[model samples]
Target chain A: MSSGYVPGLEGIVASQTAISMVDGENGRLVYQGYVIADLAEQMSFEEVAFLLWEGRLPNRSELDALSLELANHRTLTQAANITLDALPTDTDPMDVLRSVVSVQGVEHRLGKPSVPLAIHATASFPTILARFHRRQSGLDPIQPRADLGHAANYLYMMNGKESSPEVVRALNTYLVLLADHGMNASTFTARVIASTESDLISSLVGAIGALKGPAHGGAPAAVIEQLELIGTADNAERWMRDARKRKVKFMGFGHRVYRVYDPRAKILKEMCRRMNPKFYELATKVEEVALQILHEEHPERPQSTNVEFYSAGVLQAIGLPKGYFTPTFASARVAGWSAHVLEQAAHNRIIRPQSEYIGPEPRKPIPLAERV
Target chain B: MAEFSPGLEGVVAAETAVSEVDGANGRLIYRGGYLIEDLVPVVSFEEAAYLLWHGELPNESQLDALREQMATARTLNKSARGTLMAMDAATEPMDVLRTVVSAQGASKSLTKPSLDEAIALTAVFPTIVGAARRRGQGKAIVEPRADLGHAANLLWMMHGEEPAPEKVHLVDTYLVLLADHGLNASTFAARVVASTGSDLTSCVVGAIAALKGPAHGGATLAARNMLDKIGSAEDAEKWLREAHARHERFSGFGHRVYRTYDPRAKILREMAKTAAPDLHRTAARTEEVALAILHEAHPERPNATNVDFWASVVLTGAGIPKELFTTVFATSRVSGWTAHVLESLADLRIIRPASRWVGPEPGKKPLQLTKR
Candidate 1:
């Protein structure tokens, strides 16, 4: 039987996936049967990506080979470089990422999505963002270093020098946490595109477009912006209460899936406390006030800070400009997007869902000349 | 806890007033109550686009305003031009379209999707399509004429000359017919992106990426290629027999929604007689043979020719190269894509669906790399 319209497709199960699961009730994120908490601090982004793609942790040799492959594909295609140079300096980095990634993955043929291709697409995200960021800053682009890991190489390419171990570790954890979150709007966009047997780049470019939304990957920067508006910890309650009265949403506060606290946010919150003491201090106060207000209004519903809330502080601590927050999230999530694309392609079907027509009953039309 | 629907086939994911595919009765309905067959004779592509966006057909002054708005937005910005020139002339047209559109739409910050933005996005497609084609042939880019109508201008930019009236009518009709087909993969991709509250350009870009798939917009080209391989009407039966023997599925002969002949296909089938008489003759013969073979294999199935079959012949008549069939489809569907995005804004929600996990049980511990 055909189910009735499910607005936003809130609880509709679309596909059978082995990649990742969002256990909302338990506040757990599982990637390939392993809990996210176990992997977040320990596994590298490359290792998590490998696990997502291969459904198992890679041994030393396999990890090395995958790293080499990713490092080798780090350089942008010639067309991608030209396309990158073509974008205006003031353009949003997310748009730059979307466009450059499209150009970078343009192929002469239509090939089945494979791990090698996924590696090639995943490797280019950082280089695209970093190169564009540098070009905007009036600096020459820094080439990617093969010897460095994904997180370290991204910082090296963005800045002219390497980042400290602490910052690199934070970025790696951010990437690992954001890698795949099971059937998210952007990941669903990727799967829906891939469900049609589209190319991996097409699926990814589509996902990037989806992620640019304020409700999705676009929120991290908005969080920073909201926090900036709040200014200081002492002003937090007053500003938030006023903003709430004006019907302004507190950025990064509510999530659709999590009935409890998001596990990723809990980890990023701790990191923010350690690395960005000032932002952490202000953010903590704001969070407390916001949650108190939210709880006052909704009493029965769970109102906890989401990943984007603490992610703002963490990314800020890592020295990213506010504009790069969403794109940085994209850089990490490309691994997940690509992994999901591979999974969707492995057991492919065209994801053509129905729509309940709310238009008028069909009738004859007026001739163009006869109309007023 | 709902049953997992593979491909979301019968799940009604949206409530849309944009258009409706009443596949049961073989009817297609556009907004404002006009049937597809009824609307085709009265509206130009711009008018069809206006109807989709505003839910009503424009009058004389309104249509003029739309035409003026579209003409003003036809020229690509400097960044878009640079991006267009950046691609290899020989790159796939859809790839070029995807990248160039993203570059064109790249902005300094996120903006909510708007009707004005939709019109601007719809107007630029022909420019990118024409530019890609001209570059592929090493021809100087032809500037779009503000005085010409949308279809006429597209022909002018692509051919560098005034198009015959009949040819423009043919192309315009094709555009009108293919403008929207209720929640199809590409349009669904657009809505999913829009549901995240993404910008209009991101939604359109994502739609274009999904349209690049062979299973979706690429079907027109495949249908045309199949006919070309068949060579003539005489070889139709032989080709069908051999293809069937080899277990090859006929291109453009089957669809997911329609139980009878597609209404759009019926109209295009009749138009194909005069548009490209010779190709139409071969296509007609091929459809007959293909249907016969398909029926022999599955008598229970209600097999019919889909829109792509006749679209190929009509497009060939309109002088679009087979390589660009999908891009041409994008040019038409951008209006519907943008319309869906705009409609989605009234009640925006993230289209995040649930996934049934098929992997091993969660909470598994990972082995250390050296130990593994």
Candidate 2:
């Protein structure tokens, strides 16, 4: 009645969510029926998060309330703080989030997924990253500022002073753009965990793990690294061709969805061009050559620039260390992940897929003493 | 395009030689094509773990090498230790396992998943689980014993006494049996994380989060709790009948795979008689009634007792606390999780499945925050 094998589950539909949709043929992303283009520059991460959770944009009062709620929960739990301190100063921020979030989310036992828990978990991510970033840099960790909005507060905590409005707005748009992305691997991981009727933290924790992979959220850092190695626009062709010979993948160049340019990447690329001209110049040339070479190799495939490519330049402009790239991605995506978790929890089915076992036929076992 | 299959049921998401659950025939074949039944008596858990990673049965020297490798990696890293201490001892051990594993695997930078990292990750689990168990009892955390093998050391750390050979054999067999199964949810979660080119710890942490779901690794704990609720062999029929009348799904009675009896369950069912004889008697009767009731309701359903049904008893016999059952499952399954990650590295592709949009049509504009 069903197909046997679908490698990479290419065309399989694993979920049905009203949270977001990837209109791959049209190169659009929609959050609750609003095109990302309309929402990205206009919304704060908190309002978009509310839209994702409640299926509508929050009114001024509702937005204010939601912002306050997020602000209130931004500080880490004492145990979580202790756990954060326990980690090595040099530990990856993603790993710190994974562990500290677990400690922060620990309950006496399992509880059903809920909205408050999601909000709490989302708020903690920036704090965890900022604290660890400070610890790594040997700077004193700044307390979260309640007066600041989500993006501003994260900056304040990281730099110990409020950032300019432009930087905060840039980050806000970045978060809004990256907030949700249809049924991605990390979001699917969240849904899979939630489908088991597990707690929200469990789902969030699982999604974070999925995002840690370079194939998923790990590429933004690599994009910066690749650019650093290439040095300048003049070197793009030679460096990229040499990398191809060595089988060094061009990071952030492919997407399974999106026939045209990624909508998010289009927005990020603009921000990158304005904010980081040096990175933008080299990245643009690399993108041109890569697409041309890729097209020559496989004319049928739609291998275009993804969000991670220009995301490197924008994040670098915003002054996050390269190491924090994926973790920062997680901070934005946690909204999507939590929303997905809640969505899955509402009409849950245990997402246990069947495996076609291609192994030996059963036989009796020999005692160990008699084995060869 | 394939139609949406809820749960991705019957979707063969992967191809592998790690292990196979030949559900129709009730067989489990581990890597190297060794049948579960055949391998159980012939190999120790350590040897089986070696096989999963190396694709061959380890000879004595290899087994010893693996044992030595595991022993050296058994102690928790400073971060992991601090994280465990930071948690409330009364918190769910799975939460602790997830958090501490994340901490233990935390690094300054992301490293690709590797066999050495796998062994280190696997070795650290018993230490965390053992510590969590001790802390739960208001007892001091016990250190792992180098002289003890994996299963034996787990017991020694938990109880501060040498485990009996029979108990060790039962635990080891349980571990070996669960070492891998083709593309189960948790393993799929791990592979999905790895697909992102994430590190081994992140992959394993994700798997652990997925496993926390009640429908997956938590089944053993749920199965045991059900047995405790039913109380005794004499109470089995009445308890199950009432629970069935109320339409409550029995915890360990049904599986997605295994058209017949589960091979692991069958072996554990027999082992239960000698392992936890009293609980085994109760479980055996409970299984009989549950299966009968299940068959009567859905004549064509496989309706078989799964490994968790018997695993609960065996784990109990092995002196594992119920809270630690899921953590114990992680200890066994981490080897499988890491192995799948390593194998997938050879053919890494982002597992971003399509989602059929069920939301409102796009192109809606948002109102200003004040206007809204």
Candidate 3:
């Protein structure tokens, strides 16, 4: 047997399904057998969520029911509220989400025999987002309105006011774009935790913890910081030159899976254009400058704008606070985190990776008094 | 069968006044003497930080010296400042922290030299974070004031002016509450990295990265979000009912280690009493309602509130924005991260774990795909 199986296929089923696919070689992403572009443009976040969860677009009644369910669960429990109020204001939103999700496990349903826990995750996700916003803003959380769709209601609850159509569309697109990626670290973590037969909250918490790592969920915010440094288009080249000199990895340019282009970037680019043409123009210029420098530095590596680069511009245009960019990403990716956790549970197996041993050989233990 | 443990098992031997973790029970005790709650209420953030780093409460002389050292370290290197300024403003603060931290090792010497080296290293972190924050805000980084105390200087750098005594005191309390918490995942991770004989900066960098995980340091953001959703105490019970029905996890009300209570929660509860009295009352009432519901609904788990729950309330009452919750956690926990790293370095053993072989056995012949 090979020492390392690059493509881990120990128990992967051969059956084809309409969930998602990662084309690493070509750097493409597709959801439910549809290209990300198609879905981001034609569908809402709720529609994509239903597609991922139910394997197809929801029918009108199913969609409405799902939306109402999501909306109804938007507010947090009193205990959760107290907890939310207790956190340091400066805590990272990702960490906050992680803790919040773990607490959910306390009340999670564990002994069900029929429907898997992922369904419960789907039902609970909107509430998680709602509660997160409420605690951070120091505002009393808004109860979800049953009449509203999930995407629309999330914005309403977030701002404690009605959302504009444009804002809702932008947020919906962001959610769709981030709903899933390939088996990234957090997804792997979720699968690992799920394999232990631990509860879904534990799995989700594991995923959240994984996502909180700087190498993973910290990208969107990094992209924003990169753009700010470039300042005007005039300084873009100089900034790129200096960044390369310092060997700093431009936050939004590279991807582990997408070698050529992040398809989500394309969709977000479109969203930015729709949101504010001027800001979109500046964003495009920023991307052009970054791509140009990347091409010059390493032509072999595909370095194009990823979702984070476009996400920065899109979020800024929509009036999201600069600090909240990553938090917003968390809000959207919770669905993906939930989905991966459920998938891991369905075919539970512990995820324990081997390491190349490079250490001193085992020796006789010394007495503790002599160790110092 | 060789007994295998997936996680590392060993000893870390650095002397620290920071936090202690009881992994078996999931309790985190901060400092040599005080419980996390006691410190949070009675101590200023600066005093807590001093206690964690020095292994005792700072007397008047020690406090003055430490404050001066921290203030002096607040100044950012030109290169580091430029780098921070260059980052995309929309970048996640955590990501910015990571990048800056990774770069900081080269920019400054954070190694353990004499007593001076350790003090210098400890002092530089607030400067790093403060400078990064300023650069992100499109403001020039402030030089630390030698005249002020640590907490006061940090506030000065952050807000570009000296803060009121009350504001400084509030920030100091926050620092104390967050300074250390036993051997949590991030702290353990830091120890693991340090065990490899890596430098202090690398170990701290790893710890920060680990702590960024939602399950560990991210709960504050989740708590904030939950608070945002409920809007007012009047809607708390209804929100709880729906959240329960949906099976969504709530933030801050449960913990992995503490079955009865999280010690930090009590500290924060008290802080909230003085800082935001109205919010504190509401939060306390909310906790009562949540506990009642959980007792009846989830008899098996019977989860209770933890530190994040009350911390969120205290911070929100202090007028901190929700998005910054995790950032605040990062600031306070650096002392713990540093202590663990130093301990790991002192012990000087690589942390390697064994895994149960679940993949194809080494001697197994490869099966042909066509045959399958």
Candidate 4:
């Protein structure tokens, strides 16, 4: 066993994955053989999901079949439906996703990770969130429409009406950009579960939990919150400087990887400008000031704006609530999570990493009666 | 970057005082540096849990307070119960455990992992496990008894009768033996999730998902089933020889860490002789034959019999059905999982490890959808 301790396993190469790569030095993201930029604006969310799961982009007929399968699996199981209603109306949507997804997958026996399971789980996330959103607002739930594309159906289910084509297009791009990113903490969580030969839902439930943390998929809401605190473009520098001096983190700025500007962030920055100009105006100013301040503090570090920086503006423009941000990230990343699970199951090993003990030497315990 | 280590076999991910698996010497030490053998004879499962979370065993009054706290938290909240009742009675018990626990802990706010929440989470496990067990048996769910201790209450709720003292002792010992092991896969999963600054429920949920894997906690059920297949002591040699010819891996005979007999398995082996003499007879014969065959194939390997091997016999004697084996494992492991999360809270870092990218070059442009 390697006796060296790697804090956070930062430089440890845990797995060899073909699904996605974060080319941090070059500022590129690759899914299968294709660059993320090529897929972002041109492909539908379903196409990107297919590519992640199968290692290649789907053709026209294959894309149709995949879309239909995702559409068909949108309805929740009886257990999942009841579980959804069981959680409090005000419960965090991420918690709802974690609980409902667990119940939804409980009916199946522990089966190997497969594409069908991935598709079914990917399809259900939108339905789970939409239903929970409706219940919280005392509105009747809208059934998922088979005719709509993945992003459109998600929007339709949430609001009982179809969104504009451009809005749907923006969402598709956001989903595509966020679909997968190498072995991220959450994706690593999914793969770790899959390496144990656990089923797809178990892997996904674990991933959801990991993503709900404020560090990973939990960043979009914080980005929005920071922007709200800044309030306007005119106040960007002063407010951010004051907030930093008060020891508040400039949310959505730093990332562990990405030495150069993130590819997804570059694309979302453009989308924000076009779709949410007001947010774009204020956010760009804050991003500039935050980056400059961060650079001054850590000049040697690769401190740059991350994907979550502009994702808040884009998700808000697409009409999602702030609290739904992390769960929405889960909805997108479930594609990556399940794909990683399948890849892991195909070549499985139990991921039982060692730990260094830092405790007292072995000692005897006093008997219960003898204890004071 | 360090070379890719599959399953992170030798990688040391964290430094902790919670517990240690000193595999080379076959010693298992819990918090406060007490060896497993010393603690088992002196404390109940609750006291061990208290020790793991608080770094010391509770005194008499503290133990009494813990019992009362556990007793009060035994009942499932409305949402969790509704979700539990919603599942088909025929569903797998581990799935029920993962789902109901998720629902039970669902809330509007995201809270940090805490010691109090850990106790509550640990207390609720028996209630869910018992409900799932009864539902699987096509019997009515039983409410928990406040007067009974943790292990006794588990048997009482599942069987709806007074548990024999001998049986309760076996179950309690099993729980204590398995409660904590340093950085095992499930505990690693919990810490990974907790590193994201996720809530205790999220961390525990991730741990349960990992434990459902056949290579982890599910091995107990597999071990028992393999014994059932052997049928009797007389059949052990023939079954072992044939299974070896077929290249079937012996389920409970090998472990990666323990070079000698597993310390917990050693204790359980002794208890199994008295707890289920008939099964122990068959298991003893089967272990002998299996070890002989394994050694013949790989002589360099250690003489290995993991904790699962004997846990099966002991759990069987305690009257738990085979299907609930993983859930029972989770019932004990939630303590260790939450403990790792809380320990991790003092030094939280997002555990996004580096990945070895094995993919196509990133510059490849996507062909248009119609052209493709």
Strongest candidate by TM-score? 4
The residue-level lDDT of candidate 1 at A205 comes to: 96
Per-residue lDDT of model 4, residues B97-134, tens digit only = 98999999998888988888999999999999999888
CA-based DockQ, model 4: 0.83
Q: In candidate 3, how many Å is residue B18 off?
A: 24
By TM-score, the better pick of 2 and 4 is 4
Would you list the rank order by TM-score, best first?
Answer: 4, 1, 2, 3
Distance (Å) between predicted and true CA of A309, model 4?
0.9
Candidate with more favorable, higher TM-score: 1 or 3: 1
TM-score of 2: 0.96
Greater-lDDT candidate between 1 and 2 = 1
Report the C-alpha displacement of residue A86, candidate 2, in angstroms. Answer: 2.1
lDDT of each: 0.92, 0.87, 0.58, 0.91
Give, for candidate 4 chain B, the lowest lDDT window spanning 10 residues. Answer: B361-370
What are the per-model numbers of colliding residue pairs?
0, 7, 72, 1
Please write out the lDDT profile of model 2 over residues B1-372, one tens digit for every residue: 568888888777777778887777887788877778787777888888888898877666667788999999998877788888888889888898888888888888778778999999999888888988899999998888999999999988988888989888888988987888777888888877777677888788888888988888999999999999999999999999999999998988877877888888888888888899899899989988998999899998778888898999999988788888898988999989888889888878878888888889998899998888
On TM-score, the stronger of 2 and 3 is 2
Listing every candidate in turn, what is its Cα RMSD in Å to the true structure after a full C-alpha superposition?
1.2, 1.9, 16.8, 0.9
Residue pairs with clashing backbones, model 1: none
Q: Write the residue-wise lDDT of candidate 1 on A1-372 in tens digits.
A: 468888888889998989999999989999999999999999999999999999999999999999999999999988889888888889889999999999888877677889998899989999998999899999999999999999999999999899999999999999999999999999999998988777999999999999999889899988988999999999999999999999999999998889999999999999999999999999999999999999999999998889999999999999988899999999889888998899888888999999999888877889777887
Residue range B1-372, candidate 3, lDDT tens digits: 233222212222233335554433444555555555444545565566655565566666666677676666655544335444545554455545554554333321113313344455556666655665676677887877778776677667766876887767776777776777655555554554444333454455445545554556767777767767766677778887788789977777765445566656766777788887766766776787788888887788748887788888877765555655666677777776675555434435333222222222222222222332
Off by over 4 Å in 4: none
